[model samples]
Target chain A: MILKKLFSRRKEEYWWMTIAVPLVAILLALITGVIFIKATGRSPLKAYKLLFGSSGLFPSPYWKNHFAEMLLSSSMFISTGLAFSIAFKGGLFSIGAEGQFIVGGIVAAYFGYAEPFAGLPTILHLIIIFIMAMAAGGIWGAIAGWLKTKKGIHEVITTIMLNWIALYLIEDWLVTGPMKANISTGISGTPYISATAKLPNILPGTRLNISFIIIAAAVFFTWFLLYRTTIGFEIRAMGYTLVFGMEAPKASGVNVNRRIIQTMFISGAVASLGGSFIVLGILFQYPPVFEGGYGFDGIAVALIGQNEPVGIFLAGILIGALRTGATSVQLAHIPKTFPSIIEGLIVAFIALQELIRYLIMKLIVPKRSKSD
Target chain B: MDNTSLLNSSLTQTMDYAAPILFAALGGVMSENAGVFNIALEGIMRFAAFFGVWGAYISGTPWIGLLWGIGIGIVIGSLHAYITVKWAGDQIVSGVAINVMSMGIITYLLELIFKTTGYSPPVPYFGSSVNRIHIVFIENIPFLGAFSNLTILVWFAIILTVLMHFMLYRTVFGLRIRSVGENPYAAETLGINVVRIKWFAVIMGSIFAAFGGMALSLGTLSSFTNAMANGKGFIGLAAMIFGKWTPFGAMAASLLFASAQVIQLLLQVAASGFAKLIPLGFYLALPYILTIGALIGVVGRAVPPAADGEPYKKE
Candidate 1:
């Protein structure tokens, strides 16, 4: 009877469950990570301490620069996380954020170095580059959307393929051929962007730049777009077809295909902004090799944030801290990839949330209520 | 070398490249045909590659290493099956999680065991145990000469392709798997053990994927490298789709992709001037571009199983 009751479905109207489940999942993941660390003959507590210390949570003078690094990293995550969140909310999976990011960065880099753009006013140059980057990313994303609408191809497959295409195209052709800088020395990557296009540093002696403000504005814009607009309502309706019924949207004459394309365009544009920030604010040029799985990391952030803009911002910061702290763990003779394992574990645990919810319900709801 | 010899060498290289992809694609066919989207093939293959090398290094036998790889594949497969089938979890999310976990765990193990992260030490080769057979007259043939010096895994992949074709099309068990995939409710109503069949198919597919990983690490390099699987599993998934989810069709697709890869390599080597004239990126991106084109071409007509990606619920 208890087993049957446990398996039975119950209404999940309580909002606390949403907050509690991810927290519990995170806790479980950390415990699992600790076990893995212990198995490696390392003190989990020390490793974690170092991780947080380097993340700038601790007021350690030795790791003074850690906070700046964490903020810088989180900026990219916040943008990409918003990118993923936007698409996910529209019921489209935009796995090509990685590709969009690359193209965005490369396009911005190209325009930043263009001779004509070099002489423009600083604000105009930055605006033009950002717009071009968004357009490039939007075009890339729109291709996947077009395929889904016209060809019935899954975005996941197309996006995955596009990522490799973007990587190879940049690495082999652009970086090695037309974009190659310092050709006499055979160095890879393009020339540095004009100083006018560069994002001004917000803090002296730190990498933090105006990109943080831009990202914060983007987050607010996304929230406004998703919640305070008619289009957003239609998109949400199309997304929650299971809840609202697919017929209602069709009956109301909301063009589903156009919505898919629009969502993907916005998704790609946001992700491209992340790439643009990386180039203008940090690298000042498109590098031959781009490290960090910003696109995939966005998926985790979006999921943990439950597709909320503010939530994604917080999740991005959390991930950024973990990534920054992981370097310290690496210095302590532990692999830097340990934080990724914890992230993966959290996702896995989240996947099992339904089971967890059932168990929780069983524990909390009285057995006497079985008659009801 | 003459043009014919060059062509022959390229064909041989294509076969070498195709073998691992063919194995993995066939695995994809098995799982997808049974209604499970095995997105964790990449992670499974990576884990197997590591274990294949580790087992050979420890046991001093390549065969044992192969077994170890398969064993690990089964474990991962069962976990995936349990999570998706029993728990009704999101397949893509779970698959991504597995991939992420595999990356971390494998890198951790690599550092812990070998004290290095780039590559593992070379392991024993299967060639030492099994002698190569030479058919001299046939080896002289122009294109066929490519088969002259090849690993046993290449032959295994080809033979398995044919065998899988028959097994999937002609077997009772295969019918049941298909039935479950197409309509689990109907299959269950007809007394078929849907969950059990799915578990079996997933496990079998994972084993095949592991062998593909082994072919990469053991068949060629005899060592494990980080990210050595290098999106071959995704390519295999692509091949599976391009093939319309058939064993023979997947083999043909794998061969086509392999040819594209070989042509790219040839461009880099034999025609450096031309390679430079046309950006190297175009060549590198050719196979994926072709796969995407193929997907676009076939999406409407090439229908997947009706129940594919849906979690089966028993009422």
Candidate 2:
């Protein structure tokens, strides 16, 4: 009864809850890593170093390559993270970023090698491909949004089903049939993209390309649109009120269906750009088994960052750095999957924030509130 | 072969594929009936697939593997129940966490135990011919021959479907679960133990999902691959929705979805010219496409339990 009374007082819960969520997440992740690191017969200190060495925090000899890898991978994460964050802000859990990314990659890769675009100026060719990829991706994302808005089908089911469709469409149909490269070797992929369509490498001897610059601009654009604009306000409002069933809340300045579609469009375009970077910057062509991992991981990045633009950028870097570091840790005889465990634990802790708040409230508020 | 034999082969294959999906759809039905939205069915199946293999590998007994699968299901189910029921956690977030963790954890465990990355070596399995239940009378029957040489796991799946149908529609416990799902406060007022009921439903649901995973590894194949249970769990979820969350309905849905695979295989075997006319990807994507179509067709018509996915707290 005392616990129930303490819990009923909402103000007390938020006081410690704000401080505890992030603190507990980090602590729990650290404990998990330490336990697994110990299981591998390694000291936690060295294991952390090896695991984080890819972030270039330590002045190791191969730090340059490691750091560059972290930055390059982070560009993809940040872009996809932005994709998830935007839709999330619009009160939609759209996991179609995976499919959107593939759509963009397929478009970008195709246009990069298309015959009609041959001998065009580098900038013009790149511009055409970029626009095409974004359009393709936007359409892909909008399909789920359209289904949700018009057909009343849930976005989660549609997005997951779309993901599988995209996977098979690319792998089993397109790559194997129409778009299969005209090469005799066993390699299953499209033809190499022309150098003119590629994103120029920014750092010397590193894979870090102008993709990072593009993603940085995207981050700013997302922040500006979300925080400063009227459209963004309506989107955020829609999230809070979730007035999708209503035709249009004109008084509240929100068109629910239109906002849903627009949010998904922007989210898909951003995620598609992330995938295009792989084609234009790294792969230079779509691989047959371009089965995406980063796209799905974007959900984690978005949630971990709490769906904020800057938070996504930071979380992207953290996850990208860990992914890069996992290989080095694997060489040290530790399970590379340890990072995933930490990622899962972090999300789990965040999901259980309410329970954490209740426990913290019980500890800190019960005695003080007893007088009431 | 001849037409009857061809039809029989397709029927048998359909049954093989449908069993796993049926098991998972049944799991979803049970949990959702008690007001828990358990998307972690996929993750539970993945974890169970690996543990089933590990258990069998260590003990040289498939029974131990089945036990292992059930044990892990109970443990993961409790974790999910604790988060969603006890703490009022976001169901989607918790489900995503379990899935992501399962992907990495299973891969790591596979390497640690088997010293292989892609798949485990073949072990004692239920799918092996000697372990199959041979119904002598049905052995020579044409279409019925499909059920003649079936594994114990497949029989369990078919039996459980009927059991679940009866359990959900005919029993008082089923009514209580449905009532709790519909209105937890009302059920509480009627002296029903909502928490305990939710816990039981979730755990049983997870065990059913684990059975699906076992069907993937131990029932269909003698080995556990990293890709075991692939998108089958999600497909099962689709079946659950398409079936409108009933056991017999889910069974019909699973069979319908699984028939796509059967048709694809049959098409390949029948005429090379015709099979080549259609892209292989179409066959592969048929079930998913059907899923979306089915969902779109049924939207707003098939309603869920009134209080489904809502956290119930005492006033």
Candidate 3:
């Protein structure tokens, strides 16, 4: 009964609660953000107006270009959010997605930039790079899974450690030592991938590319896999049941260990796709200090989305828009990290769902009793 | 320099580096021993470091800065305790939220206060040359004398480790905390206030973690840099695990990890041919790699408190 209360939906809950809860959380976060802006002696209204104006939510002359940039950013978030959600469904916290993402990008860049693959057709080249990236990420994630089962190591610790190791290895060794571009230039980054390996832009004169469609398809595939298939059922079962204890699943003869490894491999592969998008669609070459903190941001996305694929898609866009908009807050002398504070506040509020629910219950119960 | 002197110098560096990790790991032990999984150690330390610098810069005193840092830690700890203990929130999620929030809030505050994105200006630092104690007798000794000249924080960290070992194993409050962590229901039945104990444990742990941050901003450097805590908070968690969740064990584990870091630094400075043969990344990643290895090897032997991550409920 206690477990059910913890995991299962409350019977008295209304459908609007889902939408209302997140809406309330976002509203509160924005209010808190406004207070912060005011405390810093900035005009909160101007800051927010600039934020919305730049993000293209409000009518603006350059809204189209900003919207495209938002889409590009959201694509990575969507992919990484799905990656985290997949492992989360299987009762694993694969925080090492950042490492997997980095390794995957490195491998894809290697395959794309190598002279041996230059002669291949564009379609064939892209296919090979994607597969190799996923494969590398899968292997990376599988190590964490293997340690969990074989050595009883927790994925949290292993993944966190792996993240640092991956960062150092990529930054210090691979990019600088073995794979340094032949042409020494001002910037420290790999040579651009062959034109054939690049992701085609769907929109003319904008950053919008094939990644948008790919991320949309991934979202659909994740939803279909989790809610419409038997494997998904087993994975969800494993996640929820493991919370209570091992007796129920063990008695049912499920090979929990194998499932964990498989789930993590899939998780890592999905996260790798996010990195591939950045390399192929955005950067076209891996820079020495390429964008980071996206893997960590994905955790916030997954949590706000309630680990659901469709919800994650919306949350990803919301975060993407906020991040893109935050750049304009600097116009009002506010920091770009302003949106991050809002995002953090939302996550913190989400963590306090019980408190929110209790408050709502208190407000509703007295009214119902009076009516009775 | 001779090889022996080089080794001694490296060992001294190791002791210096170990102080911060040791403080943070001891904090982790305290909180985890009381059943709160404090992944927010990193965030807490970062927040404290920023506040430490801010306070010292404003007050022209490192002692005031240290107090300000601990005060912020206590506030954050209380907030975490209220959310997790009072509201029965998920511990890990709460921790992650705290970390995320700290990064954003600290960054925003940094820009607001310092008008810079990267780091703060130099501030009044704790343990200046005059205040730093150097034992003449110990300094005269050969290899083991490397620990003679040290910052006050290093000695404080050492003393706290021993103090914590006693606090966890010898006191009535310690027994209650252990009982609350192992089985809150039984502890409650025995008239122990699980909520109060957890609140005390978490707040105390946060204060200790603040000291770790102070060690970085005041003891080691006089300024706060963006993400200065780096991954030391996580390393402290690894140390807590590597030590089998014991205070002494965590301190020892921190020393081991710090030694790896010191060796890496020594390699860079010594300019040995062997150092050139190995990639810098290998040395940079050595401590984390060793941590993972230790966790895997010690899995069966080292165990956490029974109800580590679970939120306590009163029926």
Question: Measured against the native two-chain assembly using Cα atoms, what DockQ does each of the candidate structures obtain, in the order listed?
Answer: 0.61, 0.61, 0.65
Question: Relative to the unseen true structure, what is the C-alpha lDDT of residue A182 in candidate 3, on a scale of 0 to 100?
Answer: 72
lDDT of 2: 0.82
**Tens digits of per-residue lDDT for model 2 on A1-372?**
643442333354354354456557657767886887678566788768888876554567888888888888888989888998899888787878888998899899999988889588988999999999999999889998998889877777778788888888888888788888987755568888888898988889888888888898999999889888989877877665553333344456567888899999999999999889999998988997885777777887887776778768877887788888888777666678768877777777767877766666778778878966
lDDT of 2 by residue, B163-262 (tens): 9888888999989999989899999999999999998998999999999999999999888898877878877887786677889888988998788777
All candidates: interface RMSD: 1.8, 2.0, 1.6
Candidate 3 lDDT tens digits, B153-225: 8889999999888888999888899988888999999999999999999999988988898899988889999
Instruction: Please tell me which model should have the higher DockQ, number 1 or number 3.
Output: 3
Residue-level lDDT of model 3, residues A1-372, one tens digit each, is 643432245354554566556667788888988888888789999999888888855668888888888889998888888889999988887787888888888888888889999789998999999999999888888888988888887787788888898888888888877877876555477878999899988888888888888889989988788778877777887888765654566678878788788888888888888889899988888888867878888888888877878778988998899988988989998888888888888887887878877777788767988998
Identify the runs in model 1 with alpha carbons over 4 angstroms from their true place: A1-11, A57-64, A183-188, A227-230, A233-252, A365-372, B126-137, B270-276, B294-301
Q: Estimate each model's TM-score.
A: 0.90, 0.91, 0.94
Best by DockQ: 3
Scored against the native two-chain complex, candidate 1 gets a DockQ of 0.61
Q: What is the descending DockQ order?
A: 3, 1, 2
- Give lDDT tens digits, candidate 1, residues B20-71: 8888888888988888887777888888989999999999888889899999
lDDT of 1 at A1: 65
